[model samples]
Target: MSLLNSLKWKAELQAITDTVDEYDRPKEVRTKVRDIYFVEIGITAEEKYLSQQAKTNVVRRIKCRWDNTISEKTNGLLIDGVEFNITRIYVLPEVREMELSLAYVD
Candidate 1:
């Protein structure tokens, strides 16, 4: 199947916004920015070994169309009511797509 056809999963992209409470204490707020379609990719043996060596709990990898709004400050993704933190982002400019490395949150 084509890549676009394979992108069947929809997920919410979230970002952290800093806000101050009434008492003037700073707080981190997670807000949904947008919904995106992605295709989940299986973790390979090399990636698993590297993640183990790096002590990173990478549990999922996904690919989606390039989104300019995504940045380093982007918090995490919500998929099927489960949250996953973005461990790394690999942008494929030639294809206008991005691969996201994710780890389970909590």
Candidate 2:
């Protein structure tokens, strides 16, 4: 199947905004940026070992169409009623795609 067709999983990109409540307490509000489709990529054993050694929590990788709004500041992704924190983002300019590394939110 084509890459675009393989992207069957739908996800919501979320960003955390810091705001002050009426009582003056700082609060984090999660807002959805946009919806996207992606295909999950398998994690290689070597990559897993390296991430473990580096103390990174990345457990999953997904590839989607390029989106300029997705940056390091993006908090997490909501997919299938589950939340996953975005650990890293890799941009492929040649293909206009982006790969995101994710870790389960505790």
- List the candidates' TM-scores in order: 0.80, 0.81
lDDT of candidate 2?
Answer: 0.83
Task: Write model 2 residue lDDT over 1-106, tens digit each, in one string.
Answer: 5777888999998997789999999987778878989999978787778777867777899999988878756478888888887777889998888999887776
* Residue-by-residue lDDT tens digits, candidate 1, 27-92: 867789889999988888888788778888789999999887786456789999988888778899
Report lDDT (CA) for all predictions. 0.84, 0.83
Candidate 2, 85: how far from true, in Å? Answer: 1.4
Q: Evaluated with lDDT, which candidate comes out highest?
A: 1
Give per-residue lDDT, candidate 2, residue 59: 84
Model 1 scores what on Cα lDDT? 0.84
Candidate 1: Cα lDDT at 26: 92
Show the lowest summed lDDT stretch of 10 residues, model 2: 67-76
**Reference-based TM-score, model 1:** 0.80
